[model samples]
Target chain A: AQTVTQSQPEMSVQEAETVTLSCTYDTSESDYYLFWYKQPPSRQMILVIRQEAYKQQNATENRFSVNFQKAAKSFSLKISDSQLGDAAMYFCAYRSGGSEKLVFGKGTKLTVNP
Target chain B: NAGVTQTPKFRVLKTGQSMTLLCAQDMNHEYMYWYRQDPGMGLRLIHYSVGEGTTAKGEVPDGYNVSRLKKQNFLLGLESAAPSQTSVYFCASRTSGGPSSYEQYFGPGTRLTVT
Candidate 1:
């Protein structure tokens, strides 16, 4: 079974500052996908960013980017110039390259202070 | 369009009570999934359907049964609920083919508490 680990249970960052959330996974598959999802108080899961394991280049989406170290089995999300609206529960997820099922991490609660 | 919707947003059940949660998607997606979310534990897949009338067991399927009689509807049943089963359940769907296959649209979720 594949397992995703998010060591940080909770994290906080000042407004306009940057914060990094760490994630690591255990998977034997050579090709896979990594994703970051955000869930606000409304409990709606929203996609943040995604990285393809086969791609050596990291994935970036506007202010959200991922540092994916495939060799280390680590995929971390970095929020640049964070805003209050960025506060939410962040989850790291993995999917087998062609498989549709996703394996998610425990989640990290992020608080953006004004 | 309501991408996906789950009925009985909140439910409370006794240990031996049986109930079913309904999930409907308007996107005509081929893949539908049921997941349970608990504190300190990430969302875990309970069951999923690849297409109409085809269901498959996921990571956690014990004590849970699902049926997909129609393409747009998926039902999850618990014949005998237990306190340990208390958690928030989410329903999601995605396109079968297309670049969007990996992107899952989720419902508002149903909070189920079994006493």
Candidate 2:
């Protein structure tokens, strides 16, 4: 079974600063996908970014970027120029290339201090 | 577009009671999923449907039942609710195959409590 682990239970970052959330996964398959989802107080889950295992270049979306190290099985999300609206619960998820199911980590609560 | 929506934004029930959560998507997606979100547990899949008539159990399917009679709707039912079953439920949908297939759009979530 594939499992995702997010070590940081909570994180805090000042507005306009940068913060990184760590995530690691255990998987035997070579072809897979990684994603980061954010849940705000409204309880709406939003997709932040995603990285394909076969893509050596990490995925970046505006202020959000992922550092994906396949060999280390690490995928960390970096949020730059953080804003108050960025405060939320962030989750790391994994999905195998051939599978439709997604395995998720516990989550990290991100607090953006303004 | 409405994306995905779950009915009964909040509900409370007594032990042994029964209820159903309705999920509807307007994106014409072929894949629909049901998941439960608990504190410190993120979200776990309960059941998923590949198409209109096919349903499959997910990581945490116990104590839950699902039906997909229509292509745009997926229903999750709890025959006998338990206190442990109290959690925020979410519905998601995505295209079966496409460049955006990996993306699963989520609903606002339904908060349920079983006393």
TM-score of every prediction relative to native:
0.97, 0.99
TM-score of chain B of each: 0.98, 0.98
The best candidate by lDDT is: 2
Alpha-carbon runs more than 4 Å astray in model 2:
none
For each candidate, the DockQ is 0.78, 0.89
Q: What tens digits encode model 2's per-residue C-alpha lDDT throughout B1-115?
A: 9899999999999999999999999999999999999879879999999999999999999999999999999999999999999999999999977799899999999999999
Question: Looking at candidate 1, what is the lDDT of residue A47?
Answer: 88
Candidate 1: clashing residue pairs, number: 0
Please identify model 1 stretches exceeding 4 Å from their true place. Answer: none
Interface RMSD, one decimal, each candidate? 0.9, 0.7
Q: Which residue pairs in candidate 2 have backbone atoms (N, alpha carbon, C) closer than 3 angstroms, thus clashing?
A: none
TM-score of 2: 0.99
Q: Which ten residues in a row have the lowest lDDT in candidate 2 chain B?
A: B93-102
Instruction: Please give the RMSD of candidate 2 to the true structure.
Output: 0.7
Error of 2 at B5 (Å): 0.7
